[model samples]
Target: GESVGLHLPTLSVQEGDNSIINCAYSNSASDYFIWYKQESGKGPQFIIDIRSNMDKRQGQRVTVLLNKTVKHLSLQIAATQPGDSAVYFCAENSREGAQKLVFGQGTRLTINP
Candidate 1:
């Protein structure tokens, strides 16, 4: 199965600052995406997503962008907060019926005061 990976293992941002997390995927056929945020002792929660047809999508304080030409994906957080600290992951699926999603090796985001 194809895999997704992050360029960085961790990121730190000051409060009220914006942050960008990057991911690279091996599967060019992937057409669906789901960005997830995971905190300690909890399951991954969906943050935002962008389909292959769209280059970008925004939700609340978060934004997702896809570049199929480079097989890259990114998540932008508008404002960093203490509560925003978590491990972020990007999942990709080829959109085939019942296909499994490949998740990136999460990047830990830290919010600095």
Candidate 2:
């Protein structure tokens, strides 16, 4: 299924701690996936992306894991910070026309002092 709208949940973590955000996608044929971080009043910023052919990919202080068997994806952030607090979202590249990114429900990450 394609996601036209999203309802994000909330996740709270302490500073200096690691935070893990999980997302589920309905399209098994989606070959590409991306993780984005959206700050207040700003657009979504790209963090990392993984292809369906791969199981894992890593970037600066960030990691993305894809599980095709279960249709699950996760992003791992190292050392949570106040600036890292934002709404995280996962998007799946559509296989149909235009190949637009279909975003899943996001997760709000809150860092406590």
Candidate 3:
């Protein structure tokens, strides 16, 4: 079965510092990647996304990178803030098959004052 996992379970960054979260997916066939931010007691919210055809995509204060060669995906957040504290997840989807998205285990991002 295809699965996704985070390189680290948790990441800590000082306020105003940049933060990076990494995820590796087993599905080489994945064609789309999305980064989601999940706050406590709330559903995941879309942050950024990239397609296999592109190497990187940027959104407001955030970026998503895809490395198809390594089946790796990463999310970068600029200027970490208290509001950025949450669990981040990377999800992959392949258009070739049943149209399902596989989510990574998620990484807890802690923002320090």
Candidate 4:
């Protein structure tokens, strides 16, 4: 039970501040890890990815750190802006089942004025 029950649907953020979006998963045997950003009514876009062998990976303005020891992952966005507002998701491939990605409860990232 790694799901967050705080505010479902979405989250509100400022127009120019860093935003940290979180995701909780259910499985415990997932290996591959990936982060995706999706805009309003659009498909997800790959931002960054890291295999189970690694612990952390960084992109242009984004960073993904994984904690296999805790089965948790997070995304850090630098220089937050309205353009960076989107639904961020952390997905992992199934360990032994279908091997498809089982997405966690997504946190809707909102940017304020």
Candidate 5:
């Protein structure tokens, strides 16, 4: 089954720094990967994504590196700041009939002065 809790709260971080968020998935055959950043009371915005076929993909100040060899995924934020403060999430979609998505523990990013 997929991994996620009923009420797992997000994480927090400071401003002007790099942040590393980790995620653990249940399915070993997940084919697609996506990262989303959601603000207070807003929809999750797409940050970056990768596929099971490849290993790493980078964009803007954010970099997504996938380690399918161990079913692990990570997101790296460079020079994080006030605007970068938000909830970060990692999701994996299995290559099945329905192709459902599995979410992981969300991290709440907080910027500091």
Candidate 6:
């Protein structure tokens, strides 16, 4: 079990709109950052990732932005749909051997019709 310290309990959004999920990381040394979308009971699925050296990265309808100076991370979903509704969170990894991902508090995204 990964630790996503308490944060926002949930979020609601209308269908066919953009969604933004914010996260805060405790480790400033973490070099790798990832955004994952986990369904109700399934495993987390990777959406996008960015490294400490990078400020932003895009994939499909998702974009990940990392602010190392402020230790902040955010995921932006474009034209979100009903299927996009899920628990979205951010993860950080150490650059050292045996990289293990540490998860942050997740924000549940609900798409309202």
Best by lDDT: 1
**lDDT for every model?**
0.94, 0.87, 0.91, 0.73, 0.78, 0.84
Ranking by lDDT: 1, 3, 2, 6, 5, 4
By summed lDDT, the worst window of 10 consecutive residues in model 5 runs over 4-13
- Candidate 4 per-residue lDDT over residues 1-113, each given as its tens digit: 33322125577877667776655555566678778888888999989987878888888978888777767787878878888877877788856556577666577888889
TM-score leaderboard ranking: 1, 3, 2, 6, 5, 4
Model 2 over residues 1-113: C-alpha lDDT tens digits? Answer: 46522334899999999999998887767889999999999999999999888999999999999888988889999998899999999999956567589887789999999
Clash counts for the predictions, in order: 0, 0, 0, 0, 3, 0
- Residues 1-113 of candidate 6 have per-residue lDDT tens digits of 33333257588989989988888777777888888899998999988889899999989998888877878888889998999999987888876888688887688999999
Error of 2 at 15 (Å): 0.4
Instruction: List the candidates' TM-scores in order.
Output: 0.96, 0.90, 0.95, 0.80, 0.85, 0.90
Off by over 4 Å in 3: 96-99
Q: Report the alpha-carbon TM-score of model 1 versus the true structure.
A: 0.96
How would you encode candidate 3's per-residue C-alpha lDDT over 74-110 as one tens digit per residue? 9999999899999999998987657578899999999
The predicted structure with the larger TM-score, 3 or 5, is 3
TM-score comparison, 1 vs 5, better candidate: 1
lDDT of 1 by residue, 5-105 (tens): 99999999999999999999999889999899999999999899888999999999999999999999999999888999999999999977895889999
Poorest stretch of ten by lDDT in candidate 4: 1-10
What are the C-alpha RMSDs, in order, of all predicted structures? 1.0, 2.3, 1.3, 3.1, 2.8, 2.5
Error of 1 at 63 (Å): 0.5
lDDT of 5: 0.78
